[model samples]
Target chain A: MDDILLMLPGPTTVHPRVLNAMSQAVVNHRSKRYGEILTETNELMSKMFQTENQSYLITGSGTAVMEAGISNVLNAGEKVLNVVGGKFGERFKKIADAHGIKTQELAVEWGTAVTPEQIKEALDADESIKAVSVVHNETSTGVAAPIKEIGKVMKNYDALYIVDTVSSLCGDEVDVDKYNIDVCVTGSQKCIAAPPGMAAITYSDDAWAACENVDSHTFYLDMKAYRKSGNKDPAETPYTPSVSLTYAMNEALKMIDEEGLDKRVARHHKAANATVAAAKALGLELFADEKVSSATVTALKIPEGLTDSDFRGTIRDEFGVELAGGQDHLKGNVFRIGHMGNISYKELFQTFAAMGIYLERNGIVEDGAAGVSSLVKSYL
Target chain B: MDDILLMLPGPTTVHPRVLNAMSQAVVNHRSKRYGEILTETNELMSKMFQTENQSYLITGSGTAVMEAGISNVLNAGEKVLNVVGGKFGERFKKIADAHGIKTQELAVEWGTAVTPEQIKEALDADESIKAVSVVHNETSTGVAAPIKEIGKVMKNYDALYIVDTVSSLCGDEVDVDKYNIDVCVTGSQKCIAAPPGMAAITYSDDAWAACENVDSHTFYLDMKAYRKSGNKDPAETPYTPSVSLTYAMNEALKMIDEEGLDKRVARHHKAANATVAAAKALGLELFADEKVSSATVTALKIPEGLTDSDFRGTIRDEFGVELAGGQDHLKGNVFRIGHMGNISYKELFQTFAAMGIYLERNGIVEDGAAGVSSLVKSYL
Candidate 1:
């Protein structure tokens, strides 16, 4: 089978260099050479997080680090304010609940961003709340929360701020220190343009302080263990890491360095803008609020009378383009176009060209070229 | 640096086919195509485990699944029998302690295997023990536990049998059902010859029954979630998996299928026999008892005058052969040669040749060719 162009929320199209990096021989994780690579990678990751806090690389997916962020700092029965807006947002509460941590959920409408006022109100009502957890970009809804604003409100309280930027981070604006984030997590397969199976977390001094008070129940995801191993002579993870994935991550991060984070983020923004414009040109309504739509992904409502299978299946099988359908409650109602990582204008053009042809052939739109024209205009 | 031949216990030299498989484009984890791949991979994994019990793939290292096996089936304060002989063996106890589980440690000397009699005595003494955790292969000490014997003893007890074959499965004899293993865990980077960052766990009906009674504290390593997602229409992981690694694992498993498990185990045994014979020919003392030595890794004591740096460093820098040093208290005292995965007589010849040259150059052995001659003879 020919390679399908990945336009999903994550597991983005990897660069050839990154894929080639993974093809190298596996290295001993405890060796000095691997240690040097790990140290360099962590340094680059710290820079990407825009924080002085130490960053930890985990050998699991984004959810693993997310669980690490919560379970390490907060013990069972401790109150935490979880902002629930989309699938990813609800995950924080699920993780908290799984650990037996008491969650004070601040529910927000799907496809809408959580407001700082709501967070403040919840925190005000619960003086015992130890943390406020939010997702920077909700891939399921294509909505980016106002984390910076929420961080400001959190600064006034004793609650630590935990943020999940699994789908944003390098693809959008994220200043960890400036946003007062105590614990921030990101995944490798998203904006990093690396393969999945690895994730990273940045922990502030406050988070570490909280960790000292809480008796962590986790062994593998323990942040203190990571910090201890990471502080060794050459640095290391507590356990064996995915060695090949680390190589891929190092190469991908180097690519990000070469491209410059500012330029990379701008490219994601441009692609998102092009996708949104093209959807509008096709007379399609977006699933997310325009003001809060994500810079890394765009969610468009499926055209009236068109099934998700009709839209995504044709784009994938017939056009050789893989687009993500909506998740959870939004399934069949919305379709997402991921424009993060190494995606470029060329890929964007092809995606719209396929969508336009499909819509026009299906009689959903009069002009098959309308979406492509809007995409081209945005690039210009 | 040129490619260093990996002869470590894990992260061994991967076949070009497996490495090339990882270079494929990333796919959406929730898509049908990915689900089919996942389902096929799990089926292959179950066969490798030699069990009818369902196998679940996790996006973390072997340690993560080890934690899953313990945490999911046993609750806090539940008594468990932890068999500790080496670094990896002690890890099970640590994980149990981290989760607030009451552990009755059956301590065995390092460089030695735990006898079935010892386990039977411990379980006889403690009727409240909910589980027995043991490592099949102690990589740190190059000791392979008598799990089949232990299983016979465990059959008379109510304790769930948890075995960690992180470095043993595929490279040695492992019959999960025959051994009565309730929960069996193995790593991808070890015998499977895949990249790190993924692990598999097989759960029996008794293990699932135990899980139902316990309130699991973990979120990411929650076995129930994996079981539910894996039982889906097309089968899926609870969270996003390392897509490229999954591809690599699938290809590696296919290679295993082609080679056949019986031949693969025989090959490992041959390589191990050759390594042990060569070590003896070089006048090196085996670290672990010869009777209980691992078929995948052979540990040998360093010569009287040669420093670990002088031995391993020269072998690595001058000869480009990478071997593993001892862990914990055995550091610098022992060196291990991994003969697992897709290792062949060619790689083994190069490794022994390097060792022979280094030993003779250091005046540690009278005849430089003695070790290499033994290796060649064994292969012949």
Candidate 2:
């Protein structure tokens, strides 16, 4: 198969070093050596989150830990305020509902973020709300919420704060402690650049305390079990973890450490800024609001006289660049270009180059080189 | 690190091809190509299961699917007969308890299999039982239940039959259809020789009907969502799958197809027989009853004077052969040798050679070569 540039929100382009790590031999999960690896991986994950709380690695996808974050801290019949701006934001409400927990929807525009004032008002309006759930970066619409500002507002309230940083943790700025995030979740396949099937979650002392009152309805995702097992001498997960994926994650995190998180985050920001500039140069409008645009992925509106499949299909089949189509309500109207994880200017240049050709071929833009020129200017 | 032989019951030694498959670049889980891979993988899994019922792959450990098997088809307050003979068998009851599902425990001796007559009697007494949960191969005790006979008994009852074949599925005789299994779950890292983090489950028509009546408490492992996504044109998983792990599983399943399931089962049986005979030659007793011993793993009683750590530790640190020690109450009294998934006569001979040296060093056996001689004789 030809090498295709993965420009999707997640399952992002992984570095060869990370991918090679996945080929290492499997180890016994209960062994002391394996436990040491788990300990190191968890510590690195905690450092990435910038939180004092220990991170617990899970063997499933990001959604698994998303459910774990909610189910572990809240009980059935408890009210939680769910900030629904995009697909993932709405998922918190759905998960709460699945566990019989009551949710008060604080719906926002799909491409816009919820303001701190809105959250404060919602919490002030209902004293019964036990928690406030938000998505730090909405992958669906390419919008990033102002979590630090919201954390200041949450300081005045007693509701636990839970955030999903599945796509933005390492790519963007995420200070879990500064944000007062009671429970934070991220997937390995996103900004971590590891393979899918592994996720990590961090829980604050407040969240652990709340868990005492909640009758957790899950077994595989029970945070208490994870905590008990994680507290062992060498540190371990409650169950058998994805050993190969853990190896990949360890390598990815090591890469992040070597590159420096600050530099890595800056590179991601540069990629996002360049993508936005390229879109503007190509006479394309972004799907998300400019003020709240994400640093990990950028969503662009489908150009006039072009279909979603025709546009992305030509780019993938002809140019070997795979871009993600907008999901759910935004399907066929927008496309997303993911610029997270080991993505550098070379991959970004290639992506915009293919996109420029597509726009020129479709007569949406007058010049084919416009997007690449914009990216080059931004990088320089 | 030296190449250590993984002789654990579940996370068996993985083949190089399967490991190499894990290094492939990850693809979009929602793409048509990925869906086709999912389709092929599910088909191969179904074939391995020997069931017409479609199999759904889960991106978690075997324990996750074990929980899914219970929480999806059985509701809170419903009764289930849990046949507990070993650690894994007891896990079903724990999962049911976590979901508020009532469980009637049918406790059997640790090293003995539950007879079909006992199940028939239990079902006859409990008309309210909605399901019967059993572990086909008990890794903790190295016992394989008579699932075929149990299936015949289940035919006379209205309760759904759920079986866990995590360590035994591809390595042992598991005719899901002939066994009349309503639900069967297996892990990827065991007999499949794939990496950890993926599991597959099969559900019958009756199980689906029961799922409709039950309010699934889980969102990640919800069978309804999996069924809906799996019924799509190319077939897909509800959530983002472990993409790299799926690739590895595809290669592992392809390897199984090449070897032929019958030949694989016979090889596993032969390995198990050789290990048992070797243990007898070394004057060590088998932990489980010889009649019900597992084909995938063999549990042997630790020699009277040799500690579990001393015995397995020497083999691991000196000889680089990793073996599993007993769990819970059996700790330090027994040790298990896993002979599943890509294990050959070469690996077996090496294992016995290490065992012989350890026995001689510990003064447990007069002749150090007794075990290897027995293994050679069995193979000849």
Candidate 3:
């Protein structure tokens, strides 16, 4: 089988340099050299998240961070407002429920962003709420919520603000301190351009304060223990971390550093804009509003007469360009084009060229060249 | 500096094939190809663990498996017998304590094996004990417990037998069904010869019965969810796993299959015997009794007049050989040599040669060549 380009919400296309980094010989997790690597990675994570808060390189999926964010910060029976806008957003309530934390869902329609007004209303109605969990970018619907605005509203309350930037951290601006996010968590496979396995999480003083009197009942995922160990000289994870993934993450972070976060975010914006513009030119509607469209993944409504399988399967099996189908309730109704991580403008252009030919042959669009023209115009 | 030979208990030197495996491009965890890989890996793990029982490839450290094993099988307030022999053995009790589980410590001295009589006594003393947690190979002290004997005793009781074969699974003989172990857990970086980050665990029917009534408050580490997902035609993990690590683990397991389990165990035994013979010839005392010495890692008493730092540092800095130092109260009192994983007998002899030279230069021993001679004799 030939190599297929990854165009999913996560487990993005890793750079060859980053993938090769995983081939480095295994080092003792407690060795001095490992400590140096970990400390450097931690610093890079803080810079990437735009926060001076204490950070951790935890070995688990992004969901581990979500669970830790809820398990550590809120005590049992304490109310936490979970902002539900999409599938990933709804996960906050599920995690909270699992932890026995009382939760009230601040529901927002799928493909719509959660507003500051909604957050304010939720917090105002519940003075005893200990935390507010929000997803910075809803991957399920490709909508980036107005976290800065929500953060401003959350400042008036004593609740700890937790944000899931799993699909948006480096691809979009997630200024943790500016947003007053007490905890910001992300995974390696998304915008970090690393493989799936570990998550990078940051915690503010407020977040720690909330965990002070809490009984997290977890030993492996205990945030406090990780914090205690990570704060030591040279920094370290509490247990043996996935060193191969950490090495790959270090290389990925280095690439991000070379590209510059601002330029990287702009690159993502350009890719997303080009994808959205081309889809529209091809007579496909955007699933998310243009104002709230995620810079990481662009969701497009499936055109009539084209089955989800026909669309994605042709893109993958025929052209070797793998595009992600919609998730959850939106499955078969929409398709997603992931523009995050190491995907280049050339690759993005090629992806559209292939999509153009497919659309024209399938009679979904009259002119394949029109989509190419729009993509070129957007790039310019 | 130069490439150093890893001689630690875990994160041992990975095979070149396994390292190359890590360089495979990232794939979507939910994709069909990924599902195939997962299913194949699951079958391999079941074989590797010497069980036809259900297995899960959890994305975390060996400690994660330990926590998951306890959290999933037994509930809060359930009494468990923790066989405390070394640091890893004691962790069973620590994890149980963190989860609010009632624990009775069947304490055994470090560097000593726990007897079946001790286990029988503990179980006989407590009729309500729900589980018995034991470490098959205590990496901290290089002691392989009498699990087969302990298994015989547990057969007479209703308590579930949970064995941690983290450092022993592939290096030594551990027939799960033969031992009647209900829950067996191991890690990737140990005898499996893969990188750290994942734990391979198996559960017997008896263990699943215990979990049926248990409400493990974890969403990420829940074993039941993994079991359900993995039982699908295309096996899947409950959450996004470390795909890179899984790839490496696949290659590592393949190597084990090619080498044959019986031959692999013999190789480990040969490597261990050579190291022990060489160390004893150099006037060093074995940390664990020879009767129960582990085939994976060999712990040795640090000769007097040589600080642990001076001992291990010289081996690492001068000879490019990294040996693990003792942990906890045994810190600075003992050193460990890991012979498990992809390390060859040639490297073992080289390591002994290097250690002998370091011993001579540090005035810890008179003759360096005598150690090499002993190693050669043992190999013959």
Which candidate achieves the best lDDT against the true structure? 2
The whole-model lDDT of each prediction reads 0.91, 0.92, 0.89
Residue B102 CA error for candidate 1 (Å)?
1.3
Preferred candidate (lDDT higher): 1 or 2:
2
lDDT of 3 by residue, A29-148 (tens): 888898899999999999998988778998999998889888898887999989898988888898888778898988988888988998888778778888999999898899999998
Clash pairs (backbone) in predicted model 1? none
Summarize candidate 1's per-residue lDDT along A24-91 as a digit string, tens digits.
88888989988998998998999999999888899888999999999999988998889899998899
Which one wins by TM-score: 2 or 3?
2
DockQ leader: 2
Top TM-score hit: 2
After superposition, candidate 2 runs with Cα above 4 Å error? none
Give the poorly placed runs of model 1, Cα more than 4 Å off: none
The TM-score of candidate 2 is 0.99
The alpha-carbon deviation from the true structure for residue B175 of candidate 1, after best TM-score superposition, in angstroms, is 0.6
Clashes (backbone N, CA, C under 3 Å), per candidate, total 0, 0, 0
